[model samples]
Target chain A: MSTTEAGGRIAIEVTVNGTRHRREVEPRLLLVQLLREDLRLTGTHIGCDTTYCGACTVIVDGEPVKSCTMLAVQADGAEILTVEGLARDGELHPLQRAFSENHGLQCGYCTPGMLMSAHALLARNPDPDRKQIRKGIQGNLCRCTGYHNIIAAIDAAAAAMREGK
Target chain B: MYPAPFRYHRAATVEEAIARLVEIGEGARALAGGQTLLVWLKMRFDEPTDLVDIGRLPGLRDIEQEAGRVRIGALATHARIARAPLARQIPIVGDCASGIADNQVRSRGTIGGSLAAGDPSCDWPVLLTTLDAEVHCRGPSGTRTLPADGFVQDLYATRLEHGELVTGVSFALPGKGSAGAYVGFKRCAPAFPTSSVGVQLTLNGDDCTEARIALGSAGLTTIRAKAAEAELRGRTLGAGVIAKAAAAAAAAAEPVADQRGSPAFKRSLIDALVKRGVEVARRRARGETVEVSHEYY
Candidate 1:
């Protein structure tokens, strides 16, 4: 029997992008599925469902993690950040604007995950150098743009955030 | 892919988690930094009936120094260790933790889980083996300490008993003028290491006072390069000495071929990593702030 039928969906409550949400979710339900399917916040992409690809990256409790690999139940009581929540007052996050201006993306399939990872990176390291930027987003992969633009975008975003832009 | 259907239980304490594991019977696993375990579940490599969520347990994820040794809690993430203050005492911890996988993996993978999972390709077990670290495990029967040297018995196997949880890992703080390095060969940014060498050396004016060499991804379990250690200790470290030690490490390593690399290729990597690890460690012993960023590409 499935866990839901045998017992019931586990009760989990999480604050996502400053919004409190409570739901009954399957213990097996991945966090990526909850965000993309249940919440209809499809910004998080899943290029490779395996641990790699970094296309399903999101921030849980202020740290970026692979949403596809993490179970929904594990996210209980945590604050999650998704690409859908990157903007405030209709203003794009510095990273979002930077990516757009610097051509940090090509196909953009990995944009959301890259943005999330970059957000977390900038949060921890506001003024990371090129080496640190390369290391910061090492988890993320961009099949297009050759990653130079992504690195430049993140670097520019860091500078913008530092100068209060 | 989705994880196979399994019930989840939350525990606030180690004792409670162990009790629940015993009550729930076998096929139950404690969840700590589910970086590897979740992947295993999604791949159907594991089918546990119960998953006791101990990720929120109190005081399990700390990096602290106690009684002349650094005690690392089970839940201490690689990211935490990579940036922890205790890295000053044990640089190898940060050296290895900083390069385990990628940011997401480092943000979630726990030191305890890595050691418990005992994947030969994992970082901590091999590095810990070099530091002579101790794994503190708590179970229903009682608590016991296992040396990292033999904690991993086989591939993906550990000496942990049923219902036992790795509480923390502790190791004696390296003394003054001590430095170490962990060098491993990976195909790219997100692949398991093919072969690695972790070296800890205490030098007294170019004469090696003590040396510990641990090889990873070279065999079923991380192997201690005893002959290599012997070659370094009590000897003046020079090109000749390092060459002999690297040769010893390569001789002791027994690599298996897979997609990561061939046996011959891994053996060559064994020699190269050992040599690089020793050089980096030597520079560190000389009070140079050197970070060995070896790239395969």
Candidate 2:
């Protein structure tokens, strides 16, 4: 079997949100770049090359992942969900609404990752305490809001989600 | 930034992965969850010519409990192991997994990869050493099992040869009255453990029959606190005995100063964490409920 060269492009198949996408990408293409450049889904922001900042966070198969750190080939044949796909049928996700209403975001650069991280938290735990909420967003770094409103937003969203169910 | 150029091969089976490793020889690296390797790649620390992706390999993602021991496959993600029924039943493994980096890291990191990477700061090495775990590796020469202590040779180094893949790790189940705990201290943000201690104690009618203490981030590798274990062997679980054992454990640690913490601070932290770990284990063994103070996410 002939192997693709290092700098050559290779075919990649990945499911973003619920849509399947097939594209040829460079071997060095990051999952973040693939989502932003190839697919034109820019909800996943890239803040730092280091994994410290969770600005490029996304849900891959029910788990929150740092998209910048993972290569596009690594995500081949995997299910990915970005922040843009959170809302359904023109309605905002409860977390999104909570962030807006509770002033969870300031500059909004970290909101997408924060929302995605919180979505994973709510999926695992519909009702999380303040400590849990803090732990959930520990990977996401927010410079503007100081995380006070973010924590409150998650708490309120949890309550809203529980009430809705 | 993107990683340096490298050929990628997704192996469908363990045999295929091993074969690919053999083919690629020294220029190949196995990809488990890519939590650490990807970071290193992006930083241009080390570039491999080929990446043997083992994420799809079968039979390397389960947690099995046998007659005498529990077996954890190498590809088992930390998240999966954290939620594994057998791990929760065992408790120590679950606690250790739960205490790893954070939700994002745990979700994408694998126990096998972490242990194989042989980082002294990781949680599994310390806990596995304390539990006397055995690491099973598969190579061209067939399969072999090495005791966890012998498996890790030094910092970021293992006894594993080229083309060898860690298949699984096995450890004996804790006895009826045995309990264990992993305690550590970390600074703000990301919450990497500055100094961590793993303690396991087996009790017989309020007296400790066996005790094992392992300290991580205290040296080139996790060190067993033999003197501390000896101190607690015949003594009843109490604050005084715990303090003595903790002091011995701290004295045994030989840590270096790093940005996360200082040598003196880490040495002091060893004692505090070991004391806390032993107290927590003893309390749990006595069926007493106590809140554990953990700062890490």
Candidate 3:
């Protein structure tokens, strides 16, 4: 087994939003900080230190992960997607447009995380029912809108994506 | 918030991980997905001198079937297990894994970590106990197996020693005429279970010959409903019999009151969920397809 030096800052490499980054960081630096502070990707916001809030959500290796709770060093050699990576050359992803047109955001603090969560859900289901969509984003806590618009955004995105295909 | 300063070591193999744990002695903690440990660290609830990261260990994240048993590596993520073909064959494993936290958590959290953490409200232990699963552990001394009943000792506690690491869990697959289901009630926090019930039954020509019922978030540790199992054994698994068995299971639970629910409310949920779980299992056993109710939303 390979072992790195203990009790010292370590240099690690990670792929974030289609870009490769190598940096030296403390063992305790969270992935959220590395994204926002180090890499200057402020799209991912931190709402709560606790994992309950989904504000720091990101896609790691094709799955949603809470950036606040994950150590930056631990994510070495992994593929990550922040909210900024959702668009393709200025074309907004269907989910993002759906959120905007359907009024899925009130305070907008939870929008990034909500989009990531919904992105993962649609990637797997393509066409999910109301309950599946609701359960898919259950981890994301939205204080405003009561989740009716959020669910509608996902539903509309799913329909649009299906139709576009 | 930053976690307290601690030494970190990443172990690429199971043996190396266990050796690191032994070297660090009692102040060492193993990190898998870090979903739970990271929270404890940020809160300063625990400050271990050394952390042994076992996420890089190969072959520890697989689900396989051998003969009549299904083996799941301790490192298998909840999402992987939930979507595993073998889990679908067993039914209960998939059901329980599907209900844990949500998409993100299931994608990162490992089955082994959750089982080793032994949170009373976690769904894996409750379902494993009902299915008579076996936990396999490895240490410097060698490998050992513990029955599910003996693996979990208390809330947030397990029988794992200082140098031990969970390698895998194995259990017999449900037979042709057997079925299993897990039902629970949750509010606000989707990760934690308020009251949960797991039921597995074997049907022999419309008669329930074998039954196992386990309830979680109702006691210090997940518990088996012996009286409820007895009530279902040797009887036809109809609505009336299932209701009686559910009542027996609920009566046997010793739930504690908390903000999520009161003791009495938990008991009532136990009764309601157990009946539904058993009825669902029975329907599956009979090869009848039933859609899950979306009434709770």
Which prediction has the highest DockQ against the true structure? 3
Give lDDT tens digits, candidate 1, residues A43-89. Answer: 99988888888999999988989998888888988999999899999
> Each candidate's lDDT (Cα)?
0.87, 0.85, 0.85
Per-residue alpha-carbon lDDT of candidate 1 for residues B173-239, written as tens digits (9 for 90 to 100): 8888788998887876667887878999999878998999999889898899999999999999999
Docking class of 1: medium
What lDDT does candidate 2 reach at residue B34?
85
Residue A1 in candidate 2, Cα distance off native in Å? 8.4
* DockQ for every prediction shown: 0.51, 0.60, 0.63
Which window of 10 residues has the lowest lDDT sum in candidate 3 chain A? Answer: A1-10
True contacts kept of 2: 0.58
**Top TM-score hit:** 1
Candidate 2 lDDT by residue in tens digits, B190-234 = 556888888899997669999999988888888889999999999
Please provide, for model 2 over A36-117, each residue's C-alpha lDDT reduced to its tens digit, 9 standing for 90 to 100: 9889999899998788889999999889999987888878889999998989999999999999999999999999999999
Pick out the ten consecutive residues of candidate 2 chain A with the lowest summed lDDT. Answer: A1-10
Q: What is the C-alpha lDDT profile of model 3 across A80-123, one tens digit per residue? A: 99999999999999999999999999999999999999998998
Ranking by DockQ: 3, 2, 1
